[model samples]
Target: MSILATEIWENRFFNGQWAVAEKNYAVTEVATGDQLGVMGYAQPSDVEYSAQQAKVAQEKWWALSYQERAQIFENAIQVAIDHKADIIEWLIKESGSIVMKASFETDLAIQALKNAMILPSSVQGSVLPTQNGKLSLAKRLPLGVVGVISPFNFPLYLAIRAVAPALALGNAVVLKPDERTAVCSGFVIARIFELAGLPKGLLHVLPGGAEVGEALVNDPNIASIQFTGSTEVGRIIGAGAGRTLKKVSLELGGKNSLLILDDADIELASQNIAWGVFLHSGQICMTSGKILIHQSIFEKVKQRVVEKVQQLKMGNPMDPSVNIGPLINQRQCQRVEGLVQSAITAGAKLEVGGKANGVFFEPTVLSQVTQDNPIFEQEIFGPVAVLMPFATDEEAIALANMGDYGLSAGIITSNVSHGMQVAQSLKVGLLHINDQTVNDEILNPFGGFGASGNGTRIGGPANVDEFTQWQWMTIQAQAPNYPF
Candidate 1:
């Protein structure tokens, strides 16, 4: 049952005469344990170049104008868009995300590519407010051969989110995608870029898992690193980068929070609450982890939230009626189940959905949860929510900001003053008042604070700069201070 994707062949201008080496395809349905296609192995696959070789390639790349580099990346984005169906289908099969979610992933990737392209031209630096007549200007430039590490969830989106921008900024990219999701990334785009006529080594997909990742991180020629995954791994990689003084960008783990004040509209609150916790079966790093409700409306809102989460249709990714899909794999399912089981044994009541249903872990929302339970402090990456009661606006804010993983926080309230106060009070990078911190847009800066992430995602200007070096040049009019 191999799905054959027609690989486009460009005018192969790199090796003198025109040639053709079309990208092969393989589709493995991870959920069903079905291997649908043969693996496409390049003849010269997983080949490594010396530090000097990498530098030589990088120098040639960095010498190009930003506009030229941006155009090349733009072509690659077009190639991506043309094969949207293949990419989305493969994502659904490999990642076990609902088709709707996978479709959104593809669309978001398109916007991200557009966003990523802009960085090449917009990696600007501010001129320091100099009192003297000095030509002081700072500019951000590429960090040569950039290393990118991606996770299984949203593999294409996260990988290219960094790769597109890094490539546009005249940096060669060596991508190391998650092992389970590597083939999709490795062969999926290899043909696309080949079709787009991107020079070899400008963007290469390295296969394998942790060892491959470690190799990339340790590579001296690799000037920078971009990563998206667990907080523990992010810390280890960040530490590794520090030793070598390499630039690093990370979007790590999150135990997000959501607050519901007394005055919030019940229907709207419940609707948003459902999305807050259940989106992508709550596997998203920014999915609301702890949900605090005002005691005055706790009973009423808790019931509504429970009912809403229960009503959600959980099934196969291909089913249009499915609102939630399976976990990435069995291990994740067990980990999520373990957290809830511990909480239940410790006396937390399962108000609505707690039992595992099929590949889908029932949209589990546990009530009466407190810090006494392990799930309270842990990052249970599943479709679960804890409805804790709060007395005052200050208490709600306090409860919301209590966690160390401050990636995102949500609030549902009509009072502008309270909304602003909570928004200002939270320690998270993104605070959505009257809304859940989900459905991330491509134009916004997506990142975290505290232990969640090391900085920004691909949607913002900050992300592009994180992978670059800020160089300054100044010619002072009055240089009488001290000539070194």
Candidate 2:
């Protein structure tokens, strides 16, 4: 039986139990507008209570042996695998993800859990040398409680990236998944951990609106905040967390680029561009926002990309044949439509798609897009690709660096050394050579620069730094004789 069919699907997980809240939010299927069920809607007071309980739970959790804590994650990996079908269904229905994308997200979440299994053993303290006759050491300790705010796009993967590490490092987590994807993003995770025998009160799942998020950021009991969403919301969270001097990590928006150099394979470059721009309807943060092609083969690359875009299928994601799915909601559809219309009005040629039917938007391709066009400057989180021409490598680099966001960029060329030189000049935090912009690995450091993030990296070794604090300790055989 699916977990959603049981009582576990109806309530929030907090205070070590699944409890119904005073308010509830309807969970609807984004593709079909069908109501799946309702989830507990957290108020500010609920957030406050969760934070208080999380702090209490963290103390006991941190005292456990590393092996004991690691067992829970090992169990979680199996539990997640056992329920993979239900998880993928929830993602496809609740988050508007295609079947392939949902499966990929589920795999990523499981991979994150697998990676976290090593964290308990990987955390090591260093012995330091001191001038005085004393034993000195630097140790990493958990940050009591971590507050996570995940977005609707890649909810499962984004939430697990932080939640798994924070818990593996002996910290309690209070997660606020976007209300729209509460089932797959928040409730499903709680269910997995609960089945895996995680100690009570160590993880809290709260789904709500801005009020809940603000309370999570402001709660005194929360030691740190991890957020992944739009740059606009990230700025607010950063400011609010700053007032209280809390550690915060923001993986915000991205206006990523894909550069097709003069020496590139046109077919391979075009294939990557289509995949990067249209995957998950381009809802990914690292989705290619700009496509810079060398002027010598600009038209050839554009023709290939347009042909690929026109072939993509957009509709309900439950069907395996559908490559593109609906936007998360009506607001997002309108927002994308508005951007496309505005760009078209601004003299950007809409080569293929500029139409929308209900929530499903066609794969769009635009040429002659100049910097002055809104589509060129903005991070359009839609299946829209804007193509621009560049004269030289320097011009291509300048075009890639034009936006405020410096998240991720990709370069494709037969000349590997030339691609490396261009990659170095780009301002993005993550760069790929001979690959597309939207890429991730469990062991790689995932983050961005400038408006894309606040200089915090997540994944692999970076998790040890993000989820723990460093403390220096000194000890001596006897109290050193000091002048009284």
The best candidate by TM-score is 2
Deviation from truth (RMSD, Å), model 1: 4.5
Q: How many clashing residue pairs appear in each of the predictions shown? A: 0, 0
Where does model 1 exceed 4 Å of error?
Answer: 1-27, 38-54, 123-134, 455-458, 474-484
- Residue-wise lDDT of candidate 2 within 1-484, one digit each (tens)? 6755635657544456888788888889999999888778889998999899899999999999999999999999999999999999999999999999999999999999999988888846799999677999999999999999999999999999999999999899999999999889988889889899999999999889999999999999999999999999999999999999999999999999999999999999999999999999999999999999999999999999999987888889999899999998878888899999999999999899878788888899999999888888799999999999999999999889997999999999999999998998999988999999999997888899999999999988799999999999999889878899
Worst 10 residues of 1 by lDDT: 8-17
Minimal lDDT window, size 10, model 2: 6-15
Give candidate 2's error at residue 289 in angstroms.
0.2
Give per-residue lDDT, candidate 1, residue 49. 50
Measured by lDDT, the strongest candidate is 2
Give candidate 2's error at residue 42 in angstroms: 0.6
lDDT of every predicted structure (CA atoms): 0.73, 0.92
Q: How many backbone clashes can be found in candidate 1? A: 0
